[model samples]
Target: MVEVNQFYLKFEANPDRYTLSDLNFCLNHGESLLLLGPSGCGKSTLTYCLNGLYPRELDGEMRGEIVINGKPATEYRPGEISQQVGVVFQDPETQFCMLTVEDEVAFGLENIGVPHEIMEGKINHVLEMVQLLAFKKSAISSLSGGQKQRLALACILALEPSLLILDEPTANLDPIAKKDVIHTIQSIQEKTNCSLIIIEHQLDGWTELTERCLLLNRKGIIFYDGDIRDAIAFKLDELQEQGIWLPKITQYLLKKRLKTEQKLPLTVKEFEEKPFSLFGNEEVNEGNNLPEAGLPYIKASHISWKVGQQPIIQDISLTLYNGEFIAIVGANGSGKTSFSRILAGIQRPTKGSVSIKDRKLGSWKESQLREEVGYVFQNPEHQFIANTVFDEIAFSLRLKMENEAVVKEKVQAVLETCGLLQLQHEHPYALSQGQKRRLSVAAMIVDDQPFLLLDEPTFGQDASSNAELMGLLQGRYESGATIAMITHDMELIHDFATRVIVLHKGRLVADLAPTELWQLPIEKLHKWQLALPIQVQVQNCLKKEGDYAAQSS
Candidate 1:
């Protein structure tokens, strides 16, 4: 068990004010605690506090105290903390310090000097628990977003701590992997009866597993605490008003204001079994061709790309019209990223050609190609090559050796559009994850390209940041920009995508609209390792069973 007494945490970045202020929490054995909050709410910082990173590794000021199993957490060495409390960070990629999956999984155990003789069994057990046994020797760099997450969980479980704290363990994973990881983590918690604390924004995925929920506001004080299901159902409106993500199915019922059942479902499976009077056809027309508009702005013909003797993309043919927003989804290593790079002309296909406005891509000058197509990478930090936000955004404009006045005006204009105007002087590296994503994105958008290819644009962003990015993209689409995104966030496709493309084993499987996608067999989506959002699934189910028609009758 762990207890925090009137905890106050501050940092040198702000000479005053605790990131988490006057907060008190108590966690007991065999109970799972969910920490929910908006972006920059200090939920993650609070986790660091309980695990002794607050005043130590993070170099911050700490008041009050945290006691774990009747001992001060502050007194423990990091290694000691690792034994008592295992932590899986928000970004699985950043936490990996090893070259291979096996090495990373065994890292903490080896650090604590868990004997080599006893290491194999522990490693195998956790890998099996997290369903990463087959990938034991895989390189960390080659893993899919989901595989990387599973490995992170395996690494912490190998430590076998008395408590497990996961910081958004599924943020980068696809929905299937997210659900699998969530299920596996809950099983481990129930079987071992270890104290569990999970900090996550995707609420619905964890509903079936959560026991106690703690809602932390931006100020870091607990706004609500009690039974997970009851609290969510009780304060559903308030949580939604704060722009927080509730379970998808719950939100569906809440929209209708249906007050039936003691508790609304927090997941797809639970909702499918419950009876309802509302037709699934609340807003969509039946049997109509997905909206059609305009002509192709960019087209590819028989494109085949290769690296050495291996084909990264095979016989890809596609068309992107003006002002269209498309999501390209596939499992990691399925060539979605490679395909994006090709579309942006960042990678050349060995065979065939890409046409932009009836001209071959190879015919365009480098400057002309860049002016027409902009590619944003998955790692935002890597894209930043400048000192400050202003310089980063201004770097390309300056590269043209434009006049100083022109450069300043263009940079300032983009800064305002990307919401980084206030942080113009701040080091790009020093900004928060959300800010860094926006800054990097701003650089690409400032050029005002007609076509954009983005790789995992929303992977690590907070809800607010993701929404802001979506709105910006939507505005651009309305103003005649063709946008293609490679991503793992399925909800993003369900809500914002005008078209969905699924790739499997380096081949295009399906390309259709969101409404049309719901009509396809669910198994096909799963076979491609794609996950449909819960509402889409529920809607599909209701339609198939004539539940909607019955309601109308």
Candidate 2:
């Protein structure tokens, strides 16, 4: 249904540098292809070319041929092409154009000139397919990130395009929400005969659904194009170095030096169905070695925040000790970000109060507060205040009136640590998603504040960068920094957080150690729209099988 031949592309400003070159691929009707590569490798750029958003909207030079449904893609107008190819972008908020869920889903249908009668049915059907029927009348502003993502998919599905493209659809979602989106996509594929092209970093839930995989190199060249299983099993190390994610099961096999000749598991269920000698033999000590309770460095007492008539956070009380890694997690709109803002003095609470080191947060001067606590917003762009990456990181040091030699040394160290040295002179907005995240962190941590707070720190990061960034954060924490992070990555919470705080409906629901939190009922966790990490899920599955075997014996 889709074909590309000897494709080459270079942006207008950089004529000598080809962002994408010699790209070639074809997809038949009802087939699914997974696109995998590191950040800034032209994965999203390729999607733009395929969706007709490249040459027309984004100024760029292009070559070769791209045909959709036996017709040259270049021949069709953007409006006409929308009927054949539908895309659900990575950021759902950017795709919204209407106030209500029903209107947003129907907007695309109306644009295509569908009859009012059929549009009603199409809108309702797609909304139901995505399990958003109950929210059909709700305002888009009130929906959670996960709900917004479903709404985006509903809009695309209503058009019933022959080819569906999803780029990093699960990047910003929690695990349970991620699963919900994954299931909706699978259901759509089963019901409709459409080709699928997914550009994603999360590989857990996509293995079984994808038939083929296309791996792109750093230069945007197609490195591997073949069966999904073969691409993963044979090219595991290569993919890992490319910053692409591998399934946990595959990673385990690789670590154990086990050969995947005739047997390779894609999903956890597949791995469980097959017996392995290595199962249930190792003692995995699961515990967070938190220090004894000390004097509270920061405290929040009965804090509440409301917007007009709606209360977002209510009566939340907590104490954060010095030199501890705390993870604040919850479902979308559960007030995680609101609470973080309150802690950082960005948003004042409607009731109650917060204090830093026995001093009321409000009493601290802006300059003093900034020096004592460093904050990285969920959207990195919000915190950026300089033209170039170099200046952004050096801004803090320069404000302190440090000597040129000292400022240069500190800024360069942070740049190298966060892998932004090469991008020092580049504009912050021009960098890739991963690069932006690194720059944001580099800028905030340059001053080495005593307390650091980050919202969704690993949102757009790839594997290698994630490890590198987290390692840097760990070093900072060890150097007597008190860290609090609002994240949806359960793996990060499990591995790093000394204490896990769960919020639900604007209240502190649970505050416990990572191991203790996991021991709670799965249904209870689901109530907050949370999920276990892949490693924890695997352990639970193995434990259940062992219990059954022992009972039978």
Candidate 3:
């Protein structure tokens, strides 16, 4: 149904820098394709070209043919192409055009000239498919990130497109939300029998839905294309070396040097179908030791925040000590991000007070407060203000009128530290997701703030980049900078956070060490939209099957 022949694409500014080169692929009707690659490898670019966004909506050079539904892409009207090919972007906020969930879904149908009499039925059906019918009247501004994502899908599905393209649809969602989105997609496919193309970082989420795999390299060349099982078993090392994520089960089996003549399992059920004794016991990675932090660096007293009578954060009191590595975790809309903002003074609490180093937060000058408490926003673009990367990291230094020599030296040091030295002259928006994440941290830590608040710092990043970024943060923590981060990556919390703070429905729920948090009942964790790490889940399953030795340390 879709075909690309000798395709090559490059943007206008840098004609020599091709985003995609000599790409060729075909997608038959009702087939699902999984596209995997590192950040900035043109996975998103491919989706754009297929959806008729490249060379039309965007300024770019193209050198080959793209055919959809057996018709040349150029023959379709400007907006007509979207009816056959629907795309859900990485950030659902960008896809929204209407105020409410129902309006957003019907907006697309209206534009496509669908009759008003039938739009309601179509909207209701799609929302029901995504299990969001109850939220049909919810305001778009009030929906959680996960809900927004489902609404985005509902909007696209309402169009009854022949093919669906989703670009990291679950990147911003919490654990349970991720499962919900994946299950919804599976259900849609089973009922509608539509073609699907997914560009994702989490391989485990797509394993069941994936039939074929397409691997791209740094230069956008298709290095491997084959059955999903073959790709996982034969191309694992090469893919990992190129920064593509592999399933946790695959990683574990490879670590144990176990050989399986049978098909490689993608799900836990498949793994467990074999003899339970075939799996080896692996210890869970206990997190780093808690630092002997000194007196309180930040103290929140009965803090509460609300928006138009809706309490986002309740009366919460806590003390964050200097040099402690802390992680705040909870479901979407549970107020984790709101609480972080309150501590950073980005949001004022509706009630109660906050102090830093024994001084009231309100007493400090704006300039001093900014320097003492650095905040990295959840969306990196929200905090980016400069055009070029070098200028961005050096913006704070320049505000103080530092000499050019000193400014250059400091900016260069940070660029090298974050592995962005080569892209020093590049535009901030042009960097890859992983590079942008690193740049965000580099910009904030350049001032060496005593207290740092980072929200989902590892989002859209690969394993290597995640480690490098965490190492940089660890160095700063060792130097006495108290760090508070909001994340849903349980692996990160298990391995790095000295303390884990749990929040539920705008209230503080648990404050405990990493091990203590893991020991909580599974149902309790699920209530907060959290989950045990992959290793922990496997260990627990093994224990239940009469393999106590397989229990995690």
Q: Which 10 successive residues of model 1 have the least lDDT summed?
A: 279-288
Highest-scoring model, lDDT: 2
lDDT (Cα atoms) of all candidates against the true structure: 0.77, 0.85, 0.84
Question: Which candidate, 2 or 3, would have the higher lDDT against the true structure?
Answer: 2
How many clashes in each candidate? 0, 0, 0
lDDT of 2 by residue, 1-553 (tens): 9999999999865678898999999999999999988877888888888888877876668999999999988999768888889998867787888999999988888887899977888888888877789889888987766678778888998888899999888776777777888888888888888999998876878887885899997788998999868887678678888888777666655655655456577788887787644453444446575667766899999999987777899999999999889999998778888899999988999999999999999799999999999999876888888999999999999999999999999999988888888779888987777788899999999998999999988877778888898999899998889999989888788778999899999999999888888888999999998887666776777777788878999
lDDT of 1 by residue, 277-321 (tens): 533344422222445767878888887877666676788898878
| lDDT against true structure, model 3 | 0.84
Q: Which pairs of residues clash in candidate 3, taking residues 3 or more apart in a chain or in different chains?
A: none
On lDDT, the stronger of 1 and 3 is 3
Instruction: Judging by TM-score against the true structure, name the best candidate.
Output: 2
lDDT of candidate 2 at residue 456, scale 0 to 100: 83
Clash count for candidate 3 is 0
RMSD in angstroms, all models?
3.4, 2.2, 2.7
Stretches off by above 4 angstroms in model 3 are 131-135, 253-264, 286-293, 545-553
lDDT of 2 at 174: 73
